[model samples]
Target chain A: MKTTIHLKLYAGLQKYASASDDNHPIETGDSVREVLNRLGVPPDKPLLVFINGNRSKATSLLQGEELVKVFPPMRGG
Target chain B: MNSFIGKMLNVDLTSGKIETVSIPTEWAEKYTGQKGLGTRILMEDLDPKTDPLSPQNKIVMTSSIMAGTIVSCSAKLAIATKSPQTGTITDGSIGGHAGAELKYAGYDAICISGKAEELSYLYLDPDKAEIRSAAELKGVGTFETEIRIKEMAGDPQVKVLANGPAGENQVLFSCISTERYRQLGRGGIGAVMGSKNLKAVAIRGWLDVHVPDMKECLKVAKELHAADKIDDAEYEIYTDGTPILVDFSQESGLLPTDNFQEGTFEGFEKINSASMKEVRAAKKACFSCAIACGNYLKGSKSDVEGPEYETIALCGSSIRNDSRDRIIEINSICDDVGLDTISAGAVIAYMMEMTEKGLHDFGIRFGETEKAVEMVRKIAFKEGVGAEGAMGTKKLADKYGGAEFAMHVKGMEIPGYDPRGSWAMGLAYVSAPRGGCHMSAYPIEAEAWGDLDPYTYEGKADLVVGLQNSQFAKFSMGVCDFWPVASDNLAKLYSVTYGGKWTAEEVDIIGERIFNLQRIFNIMAGFDGGDDKLPGRFHQENLKSGPPKDISMPEEAFMKSMQEYYRLRGWDDKGKPTLEKLKALGVEDRFVQQYETYLATS
Candidate 1:
């Protein structure tokens, strides 16, 4: 049986989603990098990524229902 | 004796006359330097209602006191004039070696007035100034023009600011290209120059920058540079340049796709930062900058400076072209043709919209790279259908009867960031004296990262006001925005650089004064509260994707923010500065009296 996790995006990284809300699901037991890869999110796209609001490495393991968020570099005055 | 070169060179291109005047001490004290001083000088000389493209309009280029000094990122030049685009006061700041070279040439500013009878260029050395006929140099691109001028001057160090075919043809959005790549890219400064029949200004000098205290300045600069590295956001900008924002904006649903019809583009990944990194050949640096964020990308034919964040956003996703190589080509062409990337892209996007709606048949389609290239060349040359499009987005949109989706404010095309995606930026766009500008205030940093909710309209009024004030101060100092200057540090830099004892509060007061003065200039030019508005689409359209899906900017919220902003600015409901505010800033009684009359009627 396959489990699913939720993902959120902030700032410039929100464009990768087909949906409007921040509750997209990813396959469980996948690493953060794997999840992004599956969703067509490039690994080098974001400067920082977060899991459940905490900064996490791309290789970090993901569990079902885990909330992942990603942010890109800021470019405003 | 300190900081400034202490002279202004006035060149009458028509008569081939050159004159030098001593810099007024009192004026320097009041206006600070660069943008502020340039505006004050321009206001004294030109009538507010005069046509911007007329020969009577002055093209004043001023360097700040810190420009040639070892002050961090102080190599900025301000180009000020009545704007052909907005019909109001406008100035564009460009980062390059030209301003510093001008300072070294023993002038704080170069003020050029009167129309030349024929093509001409100003050649300046440390000890001499001459007006030379530019017949031989006509029809050259900016890069070639700069190289030719340097060859003529017999110095590789000679800095040149010139126009390309776009400016030569008086394209309304044409830019004054400086140091080959850097540009005074807004409000059609190049068109103003072109109208004067001025082709270029080349200068070389060996004079040193005079600093009051070199050791103290160096110490502060080192500390600021160090702090900038630790600031992850600033650090990334240094490494990746602005193209890094491409991925984020795409993912965040603020990429401005299909003439801003959609919030995101499908082909974003192919043209983003990672791809840019793969093609980047070397890093480039501007004068006195530590962060060296500029990247030189190797093209199949030639190496070119990057399509930065603004370029990528405007020329790529905004128009649905996702090929990085094509974007790079577009960027190089804009530079060569001397057109602003933002305005050019906006105009092209408008053309695409017109084509899609069957308004005209110009063979422009989304993702048509070859057509885009041809259009750029045609616009530069003012040939065929490109002639109408060359007039800029506002005029082109008006011609096509699509002013509703033009995405311009005060006749200038807006930048890449969609206002509906960022309310404070939207307000900044409308109220900016120069029209549709991002440099006045960038609220995205605070809006995204501050404790306040990014989606909420609450407290955005204060946020926009603060950012505007700070940006004014930054420009007055003539430094790059990438510096890590907190309020306290900025106050210190101002005091030390100008010999004025300024607290952060005092600096903020100066900022408020400059901002209000610019507003007064615009008001006198006939813009008012009603003119302070965004495009209809931003106010009505819903985001088709992203977290803010189905979200449209609320008119009521925007109005409330405007009200709060006006109140905070001490301006009345009509957006006129209050008498008390002017008096508090020590503005002269004569101007204050005139403002009072305007306010009473308003």
Candidate 2:
């Protein structure tokens, strides 16, 4: 059976995301890094990943988190 | 064969002496232009011990080498002066047509000295410059000052930089307004203009700015535009402007809420990008800019060019006020009155906390929108409670007794980011040459919004130093901060316009040299490692909610990181750059000797 987790992509990563990008289906043991690769983001791109509003590593395994946010490098005030 | 324009203007307001001076060939190559060039000139013009608001103080304004070229985002100017607020060597970069106009008017920079005998404005054109009486423009807001100066010039296209009632009153954080919407908006540079009895600068120029080759310049500019479009895919500034930071700051627990007593705001959703989009009236850009990051919003009560992230965070969550309309109204008032929103919002928030804690009665509670709006005008006009508020946080804290939670580094109030969540940002704030300026070295891009660990002290020293050096170099080029142009592209840009082969490493070294120059100036002005510090709040207080909850930057770890930062910059334990390091960086022998003398005597 597949588990679902909420996903939000920001900045230029929005181009890779669709409206259905939210509530994405994933395998129970999938890593955050793996999910991003599936979504077509460049493998080497640095990202800020947060799971349930807490800073999470890209290699952290997912367990049907309530929400996840991913963003490319951005700088401004 | 370069974009130097070959000359600068020296205006002595007291004696009414307007002289055209040739730019030195050696200084041009050594310092480049803009912030770097301006600092080099400023170092030689006035003494470090000169009173910031006295007639002895001097103001240096520089046009970037890229200004008036086909370079994108090149409409930036640098203003350097000793800050009346912080008593540090402060420089601010402003975006507008004025810098480009300076280039077209056949000048690379302007050095204004001495006080005007009466209230006056400087009018400049290709032929001549005159100091004209501005007694009729007295007590006017910045918005009207710009319009009236243009009308007086009989040229609607005349670029103007004007100060308002706040500047005339010499409010410590008053800003100089340009293009009606943009400002050189930190460290009380406007107060310096006010102290000189200078009201505005009205400039009109039609002379052609030179380049090595016009055809190659255009071709290179086209390529750069294309590259910016492709490389800046992650920059949502054009669409969402700075309001995009509202959501990111909220999620990362970096937003300054309730005078930084907390990191999260319950009403944050009300002022984020999505909400801003609902009222977005128009988008604007600086001269020669393609990205056009300026967003104009129209709310029911007011319309303004911005309440950008800093304004929204500092005026919105920092004050515990969530009304977008109210924020817009406050932003409009501050812009017109020529007050810096960052300092104004931070001061108001400080007073609110003081009031809530029963230390003082400022008559405004947290989240009082109407009272905050009233205070903007009061601070500008210096009325009632505005008198003390206009003096800024450090002075108020000194008088009213709440230094621990004053929320400033040096005397300048901290901008939006709460450093507790992003640990390197704490270092950035404490170590910034200009005091509490996020633009000096923004670590938030790496820590809060990128891949770096936000809660650790490790590796922060290197990150902050690198960012500061790069930022100083970029500002020297007069490029907008929004464009994430690589060092390779910067080298390409220099080669195209100036007919010189520039390596990426050379550009990097220029950045390091400029940073060290400013540090030398600050040290000469009597700042030491002891002056580089965060307020007591960051070390002692913890946020009550969100990801950064119960987290305060550990004082010992932070001090260690700061020392490491100094070491990385080749400064001594007291944060003074050694003479050997200066000689290695090719800093002038005069500055090194001046610094040496200052160290021994002080």
Q: Report the C-alpha lDDT of model 2 over B1-602, residue by residue, as the tens digit.
A: 24877688999999999999988877766777898899988998678878999988888989888998889897698899999999998899888799998888888889998899888999988898999999999999999999998888889999999998998999999998988889885999989999999999887878877788889889988897787773354567876788888888998888899999999999998998778888998989888988778888998887898889999999999999899999999998888888989999999999999999999999988998899999999999899999999999999999999999998988999999999989999998888888999988888887777777788989999998888877877788888888877677887887787668888788878889988998888888888999989989999998877788899999999999988998999999988899999989999898888888887888
User: Per-residue CA lDDT of candidate 1, range B218-330, in tens?
Assistant: 78766765665533332666667778777556645567888888877888778877778789989877788877778889766555687888888888987888888888898
Worst 10 residues of 2 chain B by lDDT: B227-236
**Winning candidate number (DockQ):** 2
RMSD of 2: 2.2
TM-score of 1: 0.90
What are the root-mean-square deviations of the candidates from the true structure over C-alphas?
5.2, 2.2
Q: How accurately is candidate 1 docked according to DockQ?
A: 0.17
Query: Residues A1-77, candidate 1, lDDT per residue (tens digit)?
Result: 26666665543344566323445565656787787777676666544555654445678887777766565546553
Task: Find the candidate with the highest lDDT and give its number.
Answer: 2
Candidate 2: deviation at residue B18, Å?
Answer: 0.4
lDDT of each: 0.77, 0.87
